[model samples]
Target chain A: MILKNKDVLGLEELSAEEILGVLEIASRFRAVFDRPVRSVPIMRGRTVVNFFHEPSTRTRISFELAEKRLSADIVNFSTATSSFSKGETLRDTAENLAAMKIDMLIIRHSSPGAAHYLAKVLECSVINAGDGAHEHPTQGLLDIMTMQQRFGDLRGKKVTIIGDIAHSRVARSNIWGLNKLGAEVTLCGPPTMVPGGLARLGVNIEFDLKKAVAGADVLNVLRIQLERHSSKSFPSNREYHRMYGITEDVVRTLKPEAIVMHPGPMNRDVEISSEVADGPRQVILDQVANGVAVRMALIYLLSGGDPGALGVGQD
Target chain B: MEWSWQRIPSEFLVTGVKLCRQGKLGKRKGFLHVRKGRIEGLGIGTPTVEGIPALDGDGLVCGPGFVDLHAHFREPGHEEKETVATGSRAAAAGGYTSVVTMPNTDPAIDNTGMIRYLIDRGKEAGLCRIHPTGAVSPGRDGQGMTEFGDMVNAGAVGFTDDGSPIASGGLMSNALKYADVLGVPIITHAEDRSIVGKGCMHSGYWSARLGMAGMARAGEDAAVFRDIELAKAAGAHLHVAHVSTKGAVEIIRRAKNEGLRVTAEATPHHFSLDHSRCRDYSPLFKVNPPLREPDDVNAVADGLADGTLDCIATDHAPHTVTEKEHQFDQAPFGVVGLETALGVGITYLVNTGVMDMGQLVQCMSETPARIFNLPGGRLEEGAEADFVLFDPACQWVVDADGFQSRSRNSAYLGETLTGRVSATFRGGRLTWRDGG
Candidate 1:
């Protein structure tokens, strides 16, 4: 079955079969990255724009690399260089881009529903890179891909996400994707950083770091956004690390085979210890590698490339 | 003449309408004889007057013109959004004859001259009465008090720092005490800034799921509690604007039970719409004290039914289309409500069995009038004629382009509502007629 939706806005909108369909296609794209020549002509004539309204390092470059590998024409726009700095609104910018007949727009914005808004207003396919505390579908898919590589089927697997859950788009997207895959998910953070209302979404809310880390098949550690703490969500970075950080001692609580994941630019010793972030149990780099594959698969499917054709010419 | 619109016949007979006044609809169809700009005669049955113009009001409900305790005209500064003239036309279209304009303008209405300017503009428009409220602080900075007595003498109905809360409790208490001496209520745009930092919508399941910053209900409830306490201590009248949370309603309910002079008003959006409307992240649904959950919606409706909420205020805030076109987090907070308030009230409140039609009219007209101590809440003889004729069951979809207001940023745009105002009259002159 094909991916039915035109936009990959969020995992929440995707069904289980649709998600599994994306993962299966993404694994084929992952194989292409290992070839001597990584580039493909699947999207040769397609034009995709990387519209980043928020500052980013990894997500923007990952998407650009994916577009280049797929042989798609790419134009980049950031808030600093775009007409948006001169008061041109999102609608005007979108309309202008539509006028150019671009094939897809991968948007990273600071507004939670910016991607959803563009998806409604634009005719071309829309991909959400990251929207303020909202969903990062590609990141979610890549994290899921990393997990699937370790454990074939995620059903009944314990996945604990620990960090500033209140402000993490990564956490939200992972929660939706994991929940749909039948994984038992637990969220661990300070009460201020975690909203209890999320418990209604069929996830566990645990404040204790050790209890949450124990028996977890995977731990997705989100960055503690220090800039968002003007309201004092936690006392200090030191205090947060001591209380909820995934240190060497805390990592020992997990099973010997359990993995740790991070969507980085890591905070070093903030949310995760430097040792755990670089250790064998951590697959953070693998997650990043999978991000490019996941994005390539999405752009291909949204461009109407057949999933059956994805297996062709890979030998 | 400034009153050129009033140059109709000296007397007229309104026939075959159900008259609602002081929270009751007349048992039979009635006639109202308006003479010399006053209700010369009003009762059940056909009037035996000869050679007088008769206005047919068949299948229509006539009630006192609605009085709004909160609205933002955006004149003398942001006329691109709205002016007194345009806002009056919109108000008249929505069956309102008297509106209390909020003081959060470019240069706020802090002095007597600004108040007079609004009053004169309303007179020039000749559509509705504009009662301006002076800012509680000079610039609404929440630092110092304005000249409440001087502005009140120059026709200000009340005082408020409406766009933002008075952050200091001591300042709020002092303003309440000062306004109490002038016998005017100190209206508060109740919200705690610290708790509401950068929050654009209600903090709940939708917020958690959407991943946007959520404005917790405690921000509103805490501010309402503080203001009520300050009002109680000052022994003054305090009116809460846009009561959206159930906790705030319960707080106001208890304050009234204690016989403290606390009154509150709910907006049409608060009682009808909820946070789910913000799912699309459209700036149209973004408002201060953002649309809450279903429980809060029901509580606001219940508050209006039980007199915990004293009136229905439109809170008709208008912003430019360009302004509303921004991202939801970047867009200004407001929705133009003057044209859809009555329809929303009927569709959400009356049709849901939350309150009867007469009670709705009373909340819109009489209660608001009495709360602000304004005139023209009744259709009694010798009183100047001020009333609205509406088809209570008429269904019409809201189209923003058809609005009389200058701005098109309305929350109810494209929504099919259950009631429609056909005409409005003030001082025996027709101010607005539907499809005109």
Candidate 2:
């Protein structure tokens, strides 16, 4: 199965078979990560531009590293360094990049519909990095890949995404991916931060941190994103940590062998303790490594490239 | 005391004689002086009327201008929908001397700065007195409360999370308590999320028949019930917004009978129309706390007549043409109300003899001011001169194109109405004059 060269704007557009095909390709790429010669010439001549209007070091670096590993020419355009400072509109910048013959454009903007807008306007295949606290599809795919690599299969495995969910694009996208893979995903956060109607999305929601993370096969901790905090959300970061943080002591409360993961640049000492990020049960580094392979799979799948030789796609 | 008699034409005399010192000179006769536009003088005996424009008093009656407890002047962001100036002009032409604007704008009025900005804009318009309601939550997000004390200090007449229900019980209770401390009311757009599941119109035969999602009456009733209990717990006041259900009316009636500090308001659409009007799948009939059944409309009218309902609020939500032109469920919920409220009230309530003109004035003016604790609701001697001159019998067809509101989404367009405003005065100045 191959994805049409259109926008992967949301998870709702993907069929179960298409998602499995992407995952299969990601699994093959995951195996390549262990070898000494890990680079692939999948998108050798393709120019991938990482255009991030929002701040995220980990996501940007992951995409850059993923493109480099795929041998694609990459240009990282941070909002700070771009013509956005010169009052260039998002459409103008995207058109400029498209005119430069960029084959695949990965965009992250602070507005919710920014990616969809770019996808509609630009001729190249557009991948959404993150859009204002909405779905982060690539991060979600990477998370599922991490889980699938560790557990062999995710059918009926329990995964808990813990922390500020209302503002986490990661949790939303992960919920879509995890549920598609037949994982029981529980979203836990302070009531103010966790979105209502998660049950409508076929996910369990809990306010009690201990109960939410208990007996989970995987725990994905989301950062508290201090800049997104309005006055109404919480009294203080210390208070938030006291109630909801995934500290080492809190990790001890989880299923003993459950892997702990954080979409990094973690708010260590706030949302997740540094001890857990470096602990024996932690696969946070594996997530970073798998990030490239998963993104490469997405880029190849969406760019009309075949992973058939690796036995990833049926046709 | 001595007295003199004079005769004048029927149309120009706008006065109501309040008896002073009964049995003096046979009857308690007082003359009201109207000079230019302001009330120049009033005398009890030997009418010493000077160079003031005095008109005849024959079969006409006069009262203070009406005020609306709710309106939406969708300006600043969606001006293609409604502007403050046009909305205020519409209010004035609808016999409204003042209107309380809901705070669900593009950027919600969650702070004193936004409140001041709206007030300044209203002032610049120089029409009806625009008293803005501040949002109870930041951006009306419903997670927590905005600075109620600060909003109150900045002259927000009331607080509400209109266009969105405050889903959290804790937040609603806290807001009520905060408003209680500040001696203000937290007006609620009472619709429970659990019951209102993306509904477009009132749940009834029409909704089931048309296959459109229906906003159940349970939605409004459930929230009204919950908020009443929460208000009791917090010992605070909760004003139900756009009360459209009989069940909600019953709850508000019982709460008021229990001596709870509670008030409820109904929109003109609720008492004048029902769900059957939505059979055409018209977007104008779509409203949050949607138009209920005919029985509910009657119950609402009864509630208003018997003092169960405190005021008639015009939930005057305005949407752009593009926003309202979608399919029934997809289009926004609301229709323009500020300009149509008085005509609807007169045509439905007054003409039907269900409620007299005095009761209509009470609901639209006196009671709204009393409920919100505003100052200008009376036509007394020293009171600020805010009044409306309306032809009580003039019938006109509603036309959106001819409306002063920026948005042309009134559900009542083409509906025949019995009364129309001839002029409006705010603070003794003629702010709006029809056919001027």
- Among the numbered candidates, top TM-score falls to 1
Please give the lDDT score at residue B335 for candidate 2: 85
lDDT of each: 0.92, 0.77
User: Which whole-number lDDT from 0 to 100 does residue B152 have in model 2?
Assistant: 83
List ranges where model 2 is wrong by over 4 Å: A1-315, B1-48, B55-60
TM-score of chain B of each: 0.98, 0.90
Reference contacts reproduced by model 1: 0.69
Interface RMSD of each: 2.7, 13.4
For model 2, how does the per-residue alpha-carbon lDDT over B1-436 read when each residue is reduced to its tens digit?
Answer: 1211232222122333321211111133345554444444555433454443343322223446677888988765777777888888888877788889889888888899988888888999988778899999998898888888888888898899898889999999999998898988999888887677756777555553343445678888889999999999999988888888899899999999999999988889999898888755567888877888889999999999898999999888888776665446556788888788878988999999888777787788878888898877666566676766666677899988778777889989898998777666677666666566
Chain B fold agreement for model 1, TM-score: 0.98
Candidate 2 all-Cα RMSD: 13.0
Residue B64 CA error for candidate 1 (Å)?
0.5
| Positional deviation of residue B352's Cα in model 1 after best superposition, in angstroms | 1.3
